[model samples]
Target: MVRRIGLTGGIGSGKSTVAGLLVAQGAVLVDTDAIARSIAQAGGIAMPALEAAFGRSVIAADGGLDRAAMRQIVFADADAKRRLESVLHPLIGTETQRQAAAAGEDAVVVFDVPLLVESGRWRAIVDRVLVVDATEATQRKRVVARSGWTPEAVDAVIAQQAPRRLRRAAADAVIFNESMTLAELETEVRGLWKQWAAATTR
Candidate 1:
């Protein structure tokens, strides 16, 4: 049996970096972001559905989904977000499950989900949920720097998510991403990887 590890975190918490480390060690990396992008790509499995729901303006001139335009609309309207998720979530879920099932029996699989805690659907499927955590200040700074979002925009998004304390309480394993050096981070990841490998292989 392959072990499905759920990697989750708030924006800017470094969950993606940890997922990369897991990938480096040979875990099959299944990221929702990539899946979402694929679904939105022109002529993709989900593009027709998206175009039907959101209208053609959301599609770029080249025919691919205009993610930036969709993001702006979704962020501004909760209903828009819900509708978009309704269309994409099932498709993403189906694809993710299919890929996980197809991973070799000895595979160590990791699902990098940005909203795993908020979604509440993964708990039944994942063997373990690993959360990468950082302080609010750290998150704000990092997000603002990376996305060019204002502090207010960052806070608004954070406010819509499950609180850090709540997520930490629900986590089976937690990685503190507040301020460790890269080398230290890799060492921690390596230790966790070996432990996961041993547990799953047995």
Candidate 2:
């Protein structure tokens, strides 16, 4: 059977980097972020529901989700965030499951879930959770430098995420990415992938 892995990390924790390494090592990747983009794009599966729930204010001129407008609303309003997630979560879940079901039985299927720790519904589906860890200062610095987000914006995002300790507690294994070089991180993930891929393929 497939080994379903739930991978998570705070913004700028290098979680996507780790997922890329796993994919490079032959793991089948199902990225929730990518799926969300597809589903929120023009004519996507989630468009109608999203438009119905949030109205035209959240829709861009191109008929896709107006992410900036939605972000502005959700960041200020908790209820809006919940309502948005309610519309997108089920559809994201359905598509996530469909992709996993389509993978080869022996595949090491890695679900790259940015919000896995916050979602509270992934434990039943994943065989293990891999958390990518880094200090808050490091996270904030990295995110601000990379995404051009203000310190306040980064702080806002981190505030909404599961705290570092909470994420670490939920982890079956944790990768501390604070000081690693790209090559070193890649080596580490490749080693894990060899072991995990071997298990499922065997």
Q: What is the lDDT of candidate 2?
A: 0.89
What global local distance difference test value does model 1 have? 0.87
TM-score of each: 0.91, 0.94
**Can you give the lDDT of residue 118 in candidate 1?**
90
Candidate 1 clashing pairs, residues 3+ apart or interchain = none
Global lDDT scores for all candidate models: 0.87, 0.89
Regions of candidate 2 where Cα sits further than 4 Å from its true position: none
Q: Name the best candidate (by lDDT).
A: 2
- Candidate 2 per-residue lDDT over residues 1-202, each given as its tens digit: 4388899999989999999888887789999999999999999999999999889999999999998789888999999999999999889989988998898677789999988988898888888899999998999999999989899988888988999999999988899999999999988887776665666665
Given candidate 1, what's the lDDT at residue 97?
A: 83
